[model samples]
Target: MSTFFSDWYYLSIRSIKQIWRPLLALIPSLFIPIFFFVVNSSSLDAFSKVPGFPPSITYRDFIAPTALFTAVFFSSGNAGIELVQDISNGYFKKLLIMPISRLTIILGRLTEVAVQAVMQGTIVVVLLLLVGVRIQTGVLGLLAIFAMLMIFAMAWSCVSMISALRTQNARLVQSLFVVVFPFLYLTTSQAPMPLLPPTFRLIASYNPVTYIIEGVRALVLTGWGNPAIWQGFLVATTLFVIMVTLTLGSFKKALR
Candidate 1:
Protein backbone atom coordinates (compact mmCIF):
# COMPACT_ATOMS: atom_id res chain seq x y z
CA MET A 1 0.00 0.00 0.00
CA SER A 2 2.77 2.39 0.91
CA THR A 3 4.66 1.56 -2.25
CA PHE A 4 1.56 2.15 -4.36
CA PHE A 5 0.95 5.53 -2.76
CA SER A 6 4.57 6.54 -3.20
CA ASP A 7 4.43 5.64 -6.88
CA TRP A 8 1.15 7.52 -7.25
CA TYR A 9 2.69 10.57 -5.59
CA TYR A 10 5.75 10.55 -7.81
CA LEU A 11 3.78 10.16 -11.02
CA SER A 12 1.21 12.74 -9.88
CA ILE A 13 3.93 15.33 -9.29
CA ARG A 14 5.36 14.64 -12.75
CA SER A 15 1.91 15.14 -14.23
CA ILE A 16 1.38 18.36 -12.30
CA LYS A 17 4.66 19.81 -13.50
CA GLN A 18 3.85 19.09 -17.14
CA ILE A 19 0.16 20.07 -17.03
CA TRP A 20 0.56 23.80 -17.53
CA ARG A 21 0.94 23.53 -21.28
CA PRO A 22 -2.28 21.54 -21.57
CA LEU A 23 -4.04 23.96 -19.26
CA LEU A 24 -2.92 26.79 -21.48
CA ALA A 25 -4.17 24.92 -24.52
CA LEU A 26 -7.50 24.49 -22.77
CA ILE A 27 -8.00 28.20 -22.04
CA PRO A 28 -10.55 28.33 -24.84
CA SER A 29 -12.56 25.72 -23.02
CA LEU A 30 -13.07 28.13 -20.16
CA PHE A 31 -13.71 31.20 -22.30
CA ILE A 32 -16.01 29.61 -24.87
CA PRO A 33 -18.52 28.62 -22.22
CA ILE A 34 -18.50 32.08 -20.69
CA PHE A 35 -18.98 33.51 -24.17
CA PHE A 36 -21.97 31.24 -24.79
CA PHE A 37 -23.34 32.04 -21.38
CA VAL A 38 -23.49 35.70 -22.33
CA VAL A 39 -24.96 35.01 -25.76
CA ASN A 40 -27.58 32.53 -24.50
CA SER A 41 -28.57 34.70 -21.58
CA SER A 42 -29.00 37.72 -23.86
CA SER A 43 -30.74 36.00 -26.73
CA LEU A 44 -32.81 33.56 -24.67
CA ASP A 45 -33.75 35.86 -21.83
CA ALA A 46 -37.37 35.66 -22.85
CA PHE A 47 -37.23 31.95 -23.56
CA SER A 48 -37.31 31.26 -19.84
CA LYS A 49 -40.76 32.84 -19.66
CA VAL A 50 -42.17 30.28 -22.05
CA PRO A 51 -44.28 27.60 -20.42
CA GLY A 52 -42.38 24.52 -19.07
CA PHE A 53 -39.15 26.33 -18.34
CA PRO A 54 -38.24 26.16 -14.69
CA PRO A 55 -39.69 29.11 -12.80
CA SER A 56 -37.60 31.59 -10.75
CA ILE A 57 -34.29 31.01 -12.54
CA THR A 58 -32.87 33.26 -15.23
CA TYR A 59 -31.58 31.72 -18.43
CA ARG A 60 -28.08 32.62 -17.27
CA ASP A 61 -28.58 30.66 -14.06
CA PHE A 62 -30.00 27.75 -16.01
CA ILE A 63 -27.10 27.63 -18.43
CA ALA A 64 -24.24 28.20 -15.98
CA PRO A 65 -23.98 24.56 -14.96
CA THR A 66 -24.04 23.47 -18.58
CA ALA A 67 -21.17 25.79 -19.37
CA LEU A 68 -19.14 24.34 -16.50
CA PHE A 69 -19.71 20.83 -17.79
CA THR A 70 -18.66 21.92 -21.27
CA ALA A 71 -15.38 23.20 -19.95
CA VAL A 72 -14.85 19.95 -18.06
CA PHE A 73 -15.61 17.70 -21.00
CA PHE A 74 -13.37 19.57 -23.37
CA SER A 75 -10.46 20.07 -20.99
CA SER A 76 -10.33 16.39 -20.07
CA GLY A 77 -8.93 15.42 -23.48
CA ASN A 78 -5.56 16.78 -22.42
CA ALA A 79 -4.89 13.80 -20.18
CA GLY A 80 -4.79 11.40 -23.09
CA ILE A 81 -2.76 13.81 -25.16
CA GLU A 82 -0.18 14.02 -22.39
CA LEU A 83 -0.05 10.27 -22.13
CA VAL A 84 0.51 10.00 -25.86
CA GLN A 85 3.42 12.41 -25.61
CA ASP A 86 4.98 10.30 -22.88
CA ILE A 87 4.66 7.23 -25.05
CA SER A 88 5.98 8.92 -28.20
CA ASN A 89 8.96 10.28 -26.32
CA GLY A 90 9.63 6.86 -24.73
CA TYR A 91 9.07 8.07 -21.15
CA PHE A 92 6.22 5.61 -20.81
CA LYS A 93 8.48 2.73 -21.88
CA LYS A 94 10.96 3.69 -19.20
CA LEU A 95 8.19 3.81 -16.58
CA LEU A 96 6.95 0.36 -17.55
CA ILE A 97 10.26 -1.13 -16.46
CA MET A 98 10.14 0.65 -13.09
CA PRO A 99 8.92 -1.17 -10.00
CA ILE A 100 5.70 0.93 -9.74
CA SER A 101 2.25 -0.54 -10.22
CA ARG A 102 0.62 0.04 -13.61
CA LEU A 103 -2.59 1.22 -12.01
CA THR A 104 -0.71 4.00 -10.25
CA ILE A 105 0.47 5.37 -13.56
CA ILE A 106 -3.12 5.79 -14.74
CA LEU A 107 -4.35 6.97 -11.36
CA GLY A 108 -1.61 9.55 -11.19
CA ARG A 109 -2.62 11.05 -14.48
CA LEU A 110 -6.27 11.04 -13.44
CA THR A 111 -5.41 12.75 -10.16
CA GLU A 112 -3.91 15.61 -12.11
CA VAL A 113 -6.94 15.75 -14.38
CA ALA A 114 -9.23 15.94 -11.35
CA VAL A 115 -7.20 18.79 -9.94
CA GLN A 116 -7.35 20.65 -13.23
CA ALA A 117 -11.10 20.05 -13.47
CA VAL A 118 -11.61 21.47 -9.99
CA MET A 119 -9.64 24.55 -10.94
CA GLN A 120 -11.55 25.02 -14.18
CA GLY A 121 -14.84 24.46 -12.35
CA THR A 122 -13.84 27.06 -9.79
CA ILE A 123 -13.05 29.60 -12.48
CA VAL A 124 -16.42 28.92 -14.10
CA VAL A 125 -18.22 29.27 -10.77
CA VAL A 126 -16.49 32.56 -10.04
CA LEU A 127 -17.27 33.82 -13.50
CA LEU A 128 -20.90 32.74 -13.17
CA LEU A 129 -21.19 34.57 -9.87
CA LEU A 130 -19.61 37.65 -11.37
CA VAL A 131 -22.24 37.55 -14.09
CA GLY A 132 -25.04 37.47 -11.47
CA VAL A 133 -25.79 33.76 -11.43
CA ARG A 134 -26.54 32.75 -7.86
CA ILE A 135 -25.96 29.35 -6.35
CA GLN A 136 -29.13 28.30 -4.58
CA THR A 137 -27.29 25.42 -2.92
CA GLY A 138 -24.88 27.72 -1.06
CA VAL A 139 -21.45 26.59 0.20
CA LEU A 140 -22.33 22.93 0.50
CA GLY A 141 -23.80 22.99 -2.95
CA LEU A 142 -20.63 24.59 -4.28
CA LEU A 143 -18.62 21.74 -2.78
CA ALA A 144 -21.03 19.22 -4.25
CA ILE A 145 -20.70 20.80 -7.67
CA PHE A 146 -16.92 20.59 -7.47
CA ALA A 147 -17.09 16.98 -6.33
CA MET A 148 -19.33 16.10 -9.24
CA LEU A 149 -17.04 17.87 -11.68
CA MET A 150 -14.06 15.86 -10.40
CA ILE A 151 -15.94 12.61 -10.84
CA PHE A 152 -16.97 13.57 -14.33
CA ALA A 153 -13.44 14.67 -15.13
CA MET A 154 -11.98 11.44 -13.80
CA ALA A 155 -14.39 9.33 -15.82
CA TRP A 156 -13.70 11.27 -18.98
CA SER A 157 -9.98 11.05 -18.28
CA CYS A 158 -10.29 7.27 -18.21
CA VAL A 159 -11.82 7.36 -21.65
CA SER A 160 -9.02 9.58 -22.83
CA MET A 161 -6.39 7.34 -21.24
CA ILE A 162 -7.77 4.29 -22.99
CA SER A 163 -7.32 5.95 -26.35
CA ALA A 164 -3.85 7.14 -25.42
CA LEU A 165 -2.73 3.68 -24.32
CA ARG A 166 -4.27 1.95 -27.30
CA THR A 167 -3.13 4.20 -30.10
CA GLN A 168 -0.09 5.90 -28.57
CA ASN A 169 -0.84 8.73 -30.95
CA ALA A 170 -1.20 12.32 -29.80
CA ARG A 171 -3.33 13.50 -32.72
CA LEU A 172 -5.85 10.72 -32.27
CA VAL A 173 -6.09 11.28 -28.53
CA GLN A 174 -6.61 15.01 -29.02
CA SER A 175 -9.31 14.44 -31.57
CA LEU A 176 -11.53 12.58 -29.12
CA PHE A 177 -13.02 15.93 -28.14
CA VAL A 178 -14.63 16.05 -31.56
CA VAL A 179 -16.66 13.03 -30.58
CA VAL A 180 -17.64 14.71 -27.29
CA PHE A 181 -18.98 18.01 -28.67
CA PRO A 182 -22.06 16.60 -30.39
CA PHE A 183 -23.27 15.14 -27.14
CA LEU A 184 -23.34 18.64 -25.64
CA TYR A 185 -25.74 19.90 -28.27
CA LEU A 186 -27.80 16.72 -28.10
CA THR A 187 -28.14 17.01 -24.33
CA THR A 188 -30.00 19.70 -22.35
CA SER A 189 -26.98 21.97 -22.35
CA GLN A 190 -28.53 24.98 -24.02
CA ALA A 191 -32.22 24.53 -23.18
CA PRO A 192 -34.62 22.62 -20.98
CA MET A 193 -36.13 19.27 -21.94
CA PRO A 194 -39.58 20.46 -22.91
CA LEU A 195 -38.09 22.87 -25.41
CA LEU A 196 -36.28 20.04 -27.18
CA PRO A 197 -37.80 18.14 -30.09
CA PRO A 198 -39.18 14.70 -29.32
CA THR A 199 -36.27 12.91 -30.99
CA PHE A 200 -33.67 15.08 -29.28
CA ARG A 201 -35.50 14.72 -25.97
CA LEU A 202 -35.38 10.96 -26.33
CA ILE A 203 -31.67 11.05 -27.15
CA ALA A 204 -30.97 13.39 -24.26
CA SER A 205 -32.84 11.12 -21.88
CA TYR A 206 -30.35 8.35 -22.62
CA ASN A 207 -27.29 10.59 -22.71
CA PRO A 208 -25.31 10.37 -19.49
CA VAL A 209 -24.18 13.94 -20.00
CA THR A 210 -27.82 14.90 -19.59
CA TYR A 211 -27.89 13.54 -16.09
CA ILE A 212 -24.57 15.22 -15.28
CA ILE A 213 -25.92 18.53 -16.52
CA GLU A 214 -29.13 18.00 -14.54
CA GLY A 215 -27.16 17.12 -11.42
CA VAL A 216 -24.97 20.20 -11.62
CA ARG A 217 -28.01 22.27 -12.59
CA ALA A 218 -29.75 21.11 -9.46
CA LEU A 219 -26.88 22.35 -7.33
CA VAL A 220 -26.73 25.72 -9.05
CA LEU A 221 -30.39 26.43 -9.84
CA THR A 222 -32.17 24.30 -7.29
CA GLY A 223 -30.55 22.67 -4.22
CA TRP A 224 -28.27 19.77 -3.42
CA GLY A 225 -31.03 17.73 -1.80
CA ASN A 226 -32.96 17.38 -5.06
CA PRO A 227 -33.39 13.84 -6.38
CA ALA A 228 -31.95 15.03 -9.67
CA ILE A 229 -28.69 15.69 -7.85
CA TRP A 230 -28.47 12.13 -6.53
CA GLN A 231 -29.50 10.72 -9.88
CA GLY A 232 -26.71 12.62 -11.56
CA PHE A 233 -24.28 11.38 -8.94
CA LEU A 234 -25.37 7.81 -9.59
CA VAL A 235 -24.99 8.20 -13.33
CA ALA A 236 -21.54 9.80 -13.12
CA THR A 237 -20.40 7.16 -10.63
CA THR A 238 -21.55 4.32 -12.85
CA LEU A 239 -19.84 5.82 -15.87
CA PHE A 240 -16.66 6.31 -13.87
CA VAL A 241 -16.64 2.64 -12.85
CA ILE A 242 -17.15 1.38 -16.39
CA MET A 243 -14.56 3.70 -17.87
CA VAL A 244 -12.01 2.84 -15.18
CA THR A 245 -12.48 -0.84 -15.88
CA LEU A 246 -11.85 -0.27 -19.56
CA THR A 247 -8.86 1.96 -18.84
CA LEU A 248 -7.30 -0.70 -16.62
CA GLY A 249 -7.72 -3.27 -19.34
CA SER A 250 -6.08 -0.95 -21.82
CA PHE A 251 -3.26 -0.19 -19.42
CA LYS A 252 -2.63 -3.90 -18.94
CA LYS A 253 -2.47 -4.36 -22.69
CA ALA A 254 -0.03 -1.46 -22.97
CA LEU A 255 2.14 -3.14 -20.36
CA ARG A 256 2.61 -6.11 -22.65
Candidate 2:
Protein backbone atom coordinates (compact mmCIF):
# COMPACT_ATOMS: atom_id res chain seq x y z
CA MET A 1 0.00 0.00 0.00
CA SER A 2 2.77 2.37 0.98
CA THR A 3 4.67 1.56 -2.20
CA PHE A 4 1.66 2.30 -4.35
CA PHE A 5 0.96 5.58 -2.53
CA SER A 6 4.63 6.53 -2.78
CA ASP A 7 4.53 6.01 -6.53
CA TRP A 8 1.43 8.14 -6.79
CA TYR A 9 2.99 10.87 -4.67
CA TYR A 10 6.12 10.99 -6.82
CA LEU A 11 4.17 11.06 -10.09
CA SER A 12 1.74 13.63 -8.72
CA ILE A 13 4.54 16.01 -7.77
CA ARG A 14 6.20 15.54 -11.14
CA SER A 15 2.93 16.29 -12.95
CA ILE A 16 2.48 19.50 -10.93
CA LYS A 17 5.97 20.64 -11.91
CA GLN A 18 5.52 19.68 -15.54
CA ILE A 19 2.17 21.37 -15.97
CA TRP A 20 3.09 24.46 -13.99
CA ARG A 21 2.87 26.66 -17.06
CA PRO A 22 -0.64 25.58 -18.05
CA LEU A 23 -1.83 25.86 -14.46
CA LEU A 24 -0.33 29.33 -14.19
CA ALA A 25 -2.03 30.29 -17.44
CA LEU A 26 -5.28 30.30 -15.47
CA ILE A 27 -4.84 33.99 -14.56
CA PRO A 28 -7.07 35.31 -17.34
CA SER A 29 -9.35 32.37 -16.83
CA LEU A 30 -9.66 33.40 -13.21
CA PHE A 31 -10.82 36.92 -14.05
CA ILE A 32 -12.70 36.73 -17.36
CA PRO A 33 -15.67 34.98 -15.76
CA ILE A 34 -15.68 37.52 -12.98
CA PHE A 35 -15.91 40.21 -15.63
CA PHE A 36 -18.96 38.52 -17.11
CA PHE A 37 -20.40 38.09 -13.65
CA VAL A 38 -20.16 41.81 -13.13
CA VAL A 39 -21.39 42.98 -16.54
CA ASN A 40 -24.16 40.59 -17.61
CA SER A 41 -25.25 40.10 -14.04
CA SER A 42 -26.04 43.78 -13.72
CA SER A 43 -28.16 43.65 -16.87
CA LEU A 44 -29.73 40.32 -15.99
CA ASP A 45 -30.84 41.42 -12.54
CA ALA A 46 -32.58 44.49 -13.91
CA PHE A 47 -34.28 42.62 -16.73
CA SER A 48 -35.27 39.58 -14.67
CA LYS A 49 -37.20 41.74 -12.20
CA VAL A 50 -39.67 42.95 -14.81
CA PRO A 51 -43.43 42.34 -14.25
CA GLY A 52 -43.56 39.00 -16.06
CA PHE A 53 -40.40 37.26 -14.79
CA PRO A 54 -39.32 39.41 -11.82
CA PRO A 55 -35.77 38.14 -12.20
CA SER A 56 -34.95 39.20 -8.67
CA ILE A 57 -32.13 36.68 -8.71
CA THR A 58 -28.83 38.27 -7.85
CA TYR A 59 -26.15 38.46 -10.53
CA ARG A 60 -23.61 36.64 -8.40
CA ASP A 61 -25.76 33.57 -7.75
CA PHE A 62 -26.96 33.15 -11.33
CA ILE A 63 -23.58 33.32 -13.00
CA ALA A 64 -21.33 31.75 -10.43
CA PRO A 65 -21.84 28.12 -11.46
CA THR A 66 -21.49 29.00 -15.11
CA ALA A 67 -18.09 30.42 -14.37
CA LEU A 68 -17.17 27.34 -12.40
CA PHE A 69 -18.33 25.09 -15.24
CA THR A 70 -16.40 27.15 -17.75
CA ALA A 71 -13.30 26.59 -15.70
CA VAL A 72 -13.90 22.83 -15.66
CA PHE A 73 -14.80 22.71 -19.35
CA PHE A 74 -11.71 24.60 -20.47
CA SER A 75 -9.34 23.06 -17.99
CA SER A 76 -10.37 19.51 -18.85
CA GLY A 77 -10.22 20.16 -22.58
CA ASN A 78 -6.83 21.84 -22.42
CA ALA A 79 -5.31 19.19 -20.17
CA GLY A 80 -4.38 17.47 -23.40
CA ILE A 81 -1.75 20.12 -23.99
CA GLU A 82 0.36 18.83 -21.15
CA LEU A 83 0.20 15.30 -22.48
CA VAL A 84 1.08 16.52 -25.94
CA GLN A 85 4.09 18.28 -24.53
CA ASP A 86 5.12 15.20 -22.62
CA ILE A 87 4.95 13.04 -25.72
CA SER A 88 6.72 15.54 -27.96
CA ASN A 89 9.49 16.23 -25.47
CA GLY A 90 9.98 12.53 -24.70
CA TYR A 91 9.16 12.96 -21.02
CA PHE A 92 6.19 10.64 -21.37
CA LYS A 93 8.46 8.03 -22.92
CA LYS A 94 10.93 8.24 -20.08
CA LEU A 95 8.12 7.90 -17.54
CA LEU A 96 6.80 4.87 -19.34
CA ILE A 97 10.24 3.22 -19.29
CA MET A 98 10.35 3.48 -15.50
CA PRO A 99 9.42 0.68 -13.11
CA ILE A 100 6.23 2.46 -12.09
CA SER A 101 2.83 0.95 -12.64
CA ARG A 102 1.16 2.25 -15.79
CA LEU A 103 -2.06 3.03 -13.96
CA THR A 104 -0.16 5.06 -11.40
CA ILE A 105 1.26 7.33 -14.09
CA ILE A 106 -2.18 7.90 -15.56
CA LEU A 107 -3.97 8.34 -12.23
CA GLY A 108 -1.28 10.59 -10.83
CA ARG A 109 -1.46 12.92 -13.80
CA LEU A 110 -5.26 12.91 -13.49
CA THR A 111 -5.16 13.56 -9.75
CA GLU A 112 -2.86 16.52 -10.26
CA VAL A 113 -5.20 18.01 -12.84
CA ALA A 114 -8.21 17.37 -10.64
CA VAL A 115 -6.47 19.17 -7.82
CA GLN A 116 -5.87 22.16 -10.05
CA ALA A 117 -9.50 22.19 -11.19
CA VAL A 118 -10.75 22.20 -7.60
CA MET A 119 -8.46 25.09 -6.78
CA GLN A 120 -9.71 27.08 -9.75
CA GLY A 121 -13.31 26.28 -8.85
CA THR A 122 -12.70 27.40 -5.28
CA ILE A 123 -11.29 30.72 -6.42
CA VAL A 124 -14.29 31.37 -8.63
CA VAL A 125 -16.65 30.49 -5.81
CA VAL A 126 -14.84 32.83 -3.47
CA LEU A 127 -15.04 35.56 -6.06
CA LEU A 128 -18.77 34.95 -6.31
CA LEU A 129 -19.16 35.11 -2.54
CA LEU A 130 -17.20 38.32 -2.39
CA VAL A 131 -19.59 39.73 -4.96
CA GLY A 132 -22.52 38.73 -2.69
CA VAL A 133 -23.66 35.47 -4.24
CA ARG A 134 -25.40 33.94 -1.28
CA ILE A 135 -25.22 30.17 -0.92
CA GLN A 136 -28.45 29.04 0.73
CA THR A 137 -26.77 25.78 1.66
CA GLY A 138 -23.85 27.62 3.14
CA VAL A 139 -20.45 25.88 3.36
CA LEU A 140 -21.84 22.44 2.53
CA GLY A 141 -23.50 23.74 -0.60
CA LEU A 142 -20.27 25.39 -1.57
CA LEU A 143 -18.45 22.12 -1.12
CA ALA A 144 -21.04 20.33 -3.25
CA ILE A 145 -20.36 22.74 -6.08
CA PHE A 146 -16.66 22.03 -5.80
CA ALA A 147 -17.29 18.30 -5.62
CA MET A 148 -19.43 18.29 -8.75
CA LEU A 149 -16.85 20.31 -10.64
CA MET A 150 -14.16 17.91 -9.52
CA ILE A 151 -16.10 14.90 -10.79
CA PHE A 152 -16.68 16.59 -14.11
CA ALA A 153 -13.04 17.54 -14.24
CA MET A 154 -11.94 13.99 -13.46
CA ALA A 155 -14.10 12.36 -16.11
CA TRP A 156 -13.34 14.98 -18.74
CA SER A 157 -9.64 14.92 -17.93
CA CYS A 158 -9.58 11.21 -18.62
CA VAL A 159 -11.09 11.79 -22.03
CA SER A 160 -8.76 14.71 -22.67
CA MET A 161 -5.71 12.64 -21.79
CA ILE A 162 -6.90 9.86 -24.06
CA SER A 163 -7.38 12.30 -26.90
CA ALA A 164 -3.94 13.71 -26.19
CA LEU A 165 -2.42 10.26 -26.42
CA ARG A 166 -4.33 9.15 -29.49
CA THR A 167 -4.15 12.28 -31.64
CA GLN A 168 -1.09 13.95 -30.16
CA ASN A 169 -2.40 17.10 -31.82
CA ALA A 170 -2.61 20.08 -29.55
CA ARG A 171 -4.76 22.00 -32.00
CA LEU A 172 -7.37 19.27 -32.19
CA VAL A 173 -7.56 19.10 -28.41
CA GLN A 174 -7.71 22.86 -28.09
CA SER A 175 -10.59 22.98 -30.55
CA LEU A 176 -12.58 20.78 -28.21
CA PHE A 177 -13.25 23.78 -25.95
CA VAL A 178 -15.02 25.63 -28.74
CA VAL A 179 -17.26 22.62 -29.20
CA VAL A 180 -17.78 21.85 -25.52
CA PHE A 181 -18.39 25.39 -24.24
CA PRO A 182 -21.27 26.10 -26.62
CA PHE A 183 -22.94 22.86 -25.72
CA LEU A 184 -22.43 23.62 -22.04
CA TYR A 185 -23.80 27.16 -22.14
CA LEU A 186 -26.76 26.21 -24.30
CA THR A 187 -27.97 24.12 -21.40
CA THR A 188 -29.53 25.20 -18.09
CA SER A 189 -26.47 27.09 -16.91
CA GLN A 190 -27.37 30.31 -18.63
CA ALA A 191 -31.13 29.83 -18.42
CA PRO A 192 -33.53 27.14 -17.38
CA MET A 193 -34.12 24.54 -20.10
CA PRO A 194 -37.90 24.87 -19.78
CA LEU A 195 -37.69 28.45 -20.99
CA LEU A 196 -35.69 27.48 -24.06
CA PRO A 197 -37.28 26.70 -27.42
CA PRO A 198 -38.64 23.19 -28.03
CA THR A 199 -35.61 21.84 -29.87
CA PHE A 200 -33.19 23.46 -27.47
CA ARG A 201 -35.17 22.12 -24.54
CA LEU A 202 -34.92 18.62 -25.94
CA ILE A 203 -31.21 18.98 -26.47
CA ALA A 204 -30.67 20.45 -23.05
CA SER A 205 -32.72 17.76 -21.37
CA TYR A 206 -30.40 15.06 -22.66
CA ASN A 207 -27.22 17.06 -22.33
CA PRO A 208 -24.83 15.82 -19.63
CA VAL A 209 -23.74 19.38 -19.05
CA THR A 210 -27.35 20.23 -18.33
CA TYR A 211 -27.25 17.69 -15.58
CA ILE A 212 -24.05 19.15 -14.16
CA ILE A 213 -25.44 22.66 -14.30
CA GLU A 214 -28.68 21.48 -12.75
CA GLY A 215 -26.76 19.73 -9.98
CA VAL A 216 -24.83 22.87 -9.19
CA ARG A 217 -27.91 25.00 -9.67
CA ALA A 218 -29.92 22.83 -7.29
CA LEU A 219 -27.44 23.53 -4.57
CA VAL A 220 -26.98 27.17 -5.50
CA LEU A 221 -30.52 28.22 -6.40
CA THR A 222 -32.41 26.29 -3.73
CA GLY A 223 -35.57 24.19 -4.43
CA TRP A 224 -34.31 23.32 -7.93
CA GLY A 225 -34.07 19.57 -7.37
CA ASN A 226 -34.08 16.95 -10.09
CA PRO A 227 -33.25 13.25 -10.23
CA ALA A 228 -31.00 13.96 -13.19
CA ILE A 229 -28.30 15.07 -10.80
CA TRP A 230 -27.67 11.44 -9.98
CA GLN A 231 -28.10 10.55 -13.62
CA GLY A 232 -25.44 13.05 -14.61
CA PHE A 233 -23.07 11.47 -12.14
CA LEU A 234 -23.75 8.05 -13.63
CA VAL A 235 -23.09 9.31 -17.11
CA ALA A 236 -19.86 10.90 -15.97
CA THR A 237 -18.80 7.65 -14.31
CA THR A 238 -19.49 5.68 -17.48
CA LEU A 239 -17.51 8.14 -19.52
CA PHE A 240 -14.65 7.91 -17.04
CA VAL A 241 -14.58 4.15 -17.42
CA ILE A 242 -14.53 4.29 -21.21
CA MET A 243 -11.90 7.01 -21.30
CA VAL A 244 -9.63 5.29 -18.80
CA THR A 245 -9.90 1.97 -20.58
CA LEU A 246 -8.99 3.56 -23.87
CA THR A 247 -6.17 5.53 -22.30
CA LEU A 248 -4.67 2.45 -20.68
CA GLY A 249 -4.96 0.45 -23.89
CA SER A 250 -3.30 3.24 -25.81
CA PHE A 251 -0.54 3.56 -23.27
CA LYS A 252 0.29 -0.14 -23.75
CA LYS A 253 0.24 0.29 -27.47
CA ALA A 254 2.52 3.31 -27.32
CA LEU A 255 4.97 1.44 -25.14
CA ARG A 256 5.03 -1.46 -27.59
Top model number, lDDT:
1
In order of listing, the candidates' clash counts read 0, 2
lDDT of 2 by residue, 1-256 (tens): 7878899999888777664665567776567666766777777765454443315665457667788777666556546777888888998899888888888878887787777787777777777778777777678777777777777777777776777787888887666766676677669776655567798888888777788877776677674365655665676667677777777887754564
Q: Where does model 2 exceed 4 Å of error?
A: 22-24, 50-56, 223-229
* Clash count, predicted structure 1: 0
Q: What tens digits encode model 1's per-residue C-alpha lDDT throughout 1-256?
A: 9999999999999887776864467677788877888788899899889899888878878888988887777667778888888888899999989988888988889888887788777888888888788888899998888888788888988887899998887888888878887878889998899989999999999998899999999888877568989998898889889998898789766776
Model 1 poorest ten-residue lDDT run: 18-27
lDDT of every model, 2 decimals: 0.85, 0.72
RMSD of 2: 2.7
Off by over 4 Å in 1: none
Query: What TM-score does candidate 2 reach?
Result: 0.87
